[model samples]
Each structure stands twice: as structure tokens, then as C-alpha cells.
Target: MAERKLNGGLKAALEYGPILAFFIGYLQLKDQVISIAGTDYSGFLVVTALFIPLMVLTTGLLWALTGSLSRMQLATVVLVVVFGGLSVWLQDERFFKMKPTMIYLLFAGVLGFGLMRGQSYLRSVMGETLPMRDEGWMILTKRIALFFLALAITNEVIWRSLSTDAWVNFKTFGLTAAMFAFFLSQGRLLQTYGIEKDKV
Candidate 1:
């Protein structure tokens, strides 16, 4: 799970491509609803369909190139396929919308479980990329676990209270922005914890 930095563009593409694919596919297919069993489907179905294959392809390529994929990436893809397939096949938008919540909650559970076992899953993955003291890793892990839970709650709120398109936008763009901002806000803690940005 220790990954050196990939090329910036490739990193962004690998990370964001599936989300963008969903958003774009939804937009392009908004009017092209596919009918099944005399029922017409809409953007959600198209988005889920596109998102799954794109995620699988991207993650598989990453694993092929790196010879490894983290537990998180594997779980994310699995959830995407499971929930997304349910959404598409069962014609239930809730399944698609719950994907992120499930992913975030899963991560939170993992990180929490790791912490309870006196280990840091984040550190296990990022040890090479972002060296830090054990204490730092512990604190960061707790923070991230909390953040993941918060994100899950937020996703639930947004999906339930807002429109599908709005939720899609949040998934594609808003989440990325929020994560970047949170990362930026952690600069001081990272610096204190022996972050070697220059070397990295």
C-alpha cells in the first residue's frame, strides 16, 4: 500500500475519473431513459451503469501498474458495483445514492477498528508517501475517521434533502474540493509531524 507519487495528471484522473464519468453520463443520458419491464429509467440508471465500469477499469489499471491496490480502493469498487448494480437493476435511486455513505462509513469503521487494535491503516498505506510519527498517525487517523463519518452523514442529508443532479454535483466536485481544503488545513499538523514535502 505504500505508493510513491504518481504523475499529477494521472493521479487526478485515476481518482476523479469515475465520479466525472457518472456526472457526465447522467447529463448526457437525462433524456435517453432506458425502459425495462414497461418502466422508464432516468439519469440515475445511466450514471450508475457508467460509473461501475469506469471505476473497475481505472482501479484495475492502477493495480496492474502498481502491483497493489489498497483495501480502500478495493472496497470502494466493490460497493460501487454492488450498490450501483442494485440501483440500476432494481430501479431504486436510493441504492445509488447510498454508495458514498456506505464507502465513507466502511472507511470510518476500518480506521476506527485499526485504531482500536493499536494500528493505523492510513499510516500503513501512506507510510512511504507521508512519513510521520506514530503519535501523528494516531491523531490523524482519529480525525479522518471522524471526518469520514461526517461525510457519510452529509451525504445522507444531501441525497435525502436535495435533488439527484445536485447530489451528483456534490459527489463529483464538491467532495473533492472539501477534501482538498481539509488537506490544506492539515498542513501545520503535517509539518509538525515530520512531513517531508520537499523530498516527496
Candidate 2:
């Protein structure tokens, strides 16, 4: 696939369309029962089975459109297939439920590893978009890494202590909101550390 610049709308669709489909699939199928190989499965499992393939499809589409996938996107798709496949194969949803926790923890660990080496992987990924001094990058990376750990813990607690429906809602909306708020709260740091681009 050749590298191509994607318009914002197309990019967003490729990134988020599968998640929206999964949510809608679960909502519409939750009351229905599915049978596979003479065993009954809940709508959650069925939706997850569908979601795994949808995720793969969207990921492929993204690669086709952009000629590459980010590490984050690759990790997410792989985890979804692994955990979601287990949920469908074993007729249990717990594995799928743990996917978010696993992803967040993995991300946190990766960032922590970078921090241990006195490097900012976050800056490597976002530096072009958010230019800042090395000190600023290190500070932001530490904060984001800690935030990912907190999100991992939060996912574990919510899934274990709450209803499946509640967990789904939290996974879909609560996490998104929390991330948005976290970044929004970093406005001060962004402003303080941002390097002004030279005007043409």
C-alpha cells in the first residue's frame, strides 16, 4: 500500500467505526441468544465474536488507506483478537472484559520502560505535533504513563465490581471522557512548554 494522506472524516471512520459497530451490535443483540456448536452463548459473546473480525477489517482498511499502522493500533487489534477470541471460543465474556486492563497495563509498562531509560516514547510519537523541550517531554511522558496505570486499575475495578452493562458503558464512555479530561487538564503544560514555530 502506498502512503496516502487521509482526510479527517475518513481517518476518524477508520479509527472508530468498528468500536461504534461493536457497541451497536451489543445493544441490539443483548436480549438474543446465540447457539454455536450446540452450546448457548450470550449476546455479549456473540457481539464480541463479531467485533473481533470487525476490528481486523477496520485495521486492514486503515493500513490500506494509510500504508501503515501505528504501534498502538497494532497492539489494540492483536489484543482484541486474542481476548475476544477467547471469549467466543470458551463461551465466556470475562476474557474480553479484561482486554482494556491488559492494554492499558501493557501501554503503561512500555512507557515505564522508556522512562527507565530516560527517554520519552510519547514524545517520539507526538513530538511533531507538540514540539517541546526535552524536559517538558520527560515530564509529560511520566504523567501520561502514570495516567495509563491508573486507567488500568480503574478498568479492573469496574469490570470486577460492576454489572457487565455498566462495565461496557464505562469502557465506551467513561474511559473516553477520562482521557479527554486528562489531556484537557494538561493545557497548562502544553502552553508552558510549547515551542513556537517560526513563521514563514
Expressed as tens digits, the lDDT of each residue in 1-200 for candidate 1 is 55454677886788788788777788888767787678888867866777889889999888766668888889989998999899988989899899999999999999999999999999988887788888999989999999899999999999999988789889988888878887888887888886565654
Candidate 2 lDDT over residue span 2-85, tens digit each: 667888998888777887787888899898898888889899999899889888998998898889887888999999999999
RMSD of 1: 2.6
**What's the residue-level lDDT of 6 in candidate 1?**
66
Q: Which stretches of candidate 1 lie over 4 Å from their true place?
A: 1-5, 36-39, 195-200
How close is each model in CA RMSD to the real structure?
A: 2.6, 1.7
Poorest lDDT segment (10 consecutive residues) of candidate 1? 1-10
lDDT of each: 0.86, 0.89
How does residue 106 of candidate 1 score in lDDT? 93
Error (Å) of candidate 2 at residue 181 is 1.1
Runs of candidate 2 exceeding 4 Å displacement = 1-3
What global local distance difference test value does model 1 have? 0.86
Query: What value does the lDDT take at residue 168 in candidate 2?
Result: 84
